[model samples]
Target: MPTLRDIMTPGLVTVDPQATLKEVATLMLEQDIGAVLVMDGEHPSGIITDRDIVVRAVAYGHDYGTAVTDYTTGSVFTMEADTDVQQAAREMADRQLRRLPVTEGGRVVGMVSLGDLAVRTGGSADETALQGVSQPSADPQ
Candidate 1:
């Protein structure tokens, strides 16, 4: 089995906690990614996903210029770069998270998604990564 460092996308794009939702959305679009790591001066602070924009920003009727810190999900779950793929998958399953940041010494290094795990574990579909996992609450608070 491959280590997370073997399959994770390195040099991930990150955003500031104080950045505007509009800025985050634009960065997502520009990067062609579904999520962005939120950083506090090089330390991982939180994460902002596309769902966050739709549910927390759009659905809540908050302006795009709203601060991302106001809507970002903090207390992010992370994994070390050298962690075994199975362990990483299990952690994601336990947390009911679709994505997990790969870190080293409290700094963001990369990110892993359900698709990445499925591909590594020989699962049929990326969606199967969520199997045997509890569903996380949709509420962002």
Candidate 2:
């Protein structure tokens, strides 16, 4: 089995937690990426996704200047870089998470996304994992 170290995108584009939603949205658009890690010092504190902006901020009638920490998913889950990709996929599927910060020695090293696993694994397992991750639930939290 491949390890996350082999497939995780090995550099993170991050923003400080105090950054405004507008700034985060602009960064996501400019980078053409759906997610950005939110940092506290050198450690990842949370993740902000495009969907988060729409659902958590805009839907709540928050102004663009609202701090990202006000809406970012603060209960973040991280995976070790050496963890098996299959296990990571299972965890993501189970948690309905699209992206996970990859860590080494308690420091963030990279990120693993559902799309990354789907593209790399290329099998029924990957398809199943993708489907699981994509299924919508009544709970959006």
Highest TM-score, which number?
A: 2
RMSD for all candidates, in order, please.
2.4, 1.7
| Candidate 1 stretches greater than 4 Å from native | 124-128, 133-141
The whole-model lDDT of each prediction reads 0.82, 0.85
TM-score per model over all chains:
0.88, 0.90
Q: Per model, how many backbone clashes are there?
A: 0, 0
Per-residue lDDT tens digits of candidate 2, residues 1-141?
Answer: 798888889878899988999999999989888999999998778888999899988998889998999888877899899998888888888887788889998899998887788776665346656777789966967
lDDT at 33 for candidate 2?
88
In candidate 1, what are the lDDT values of residues 43-78, reduced to their tens digit?
878888999899888997888888899888889889
* 47: Cα error in model 2, Å: 1.0
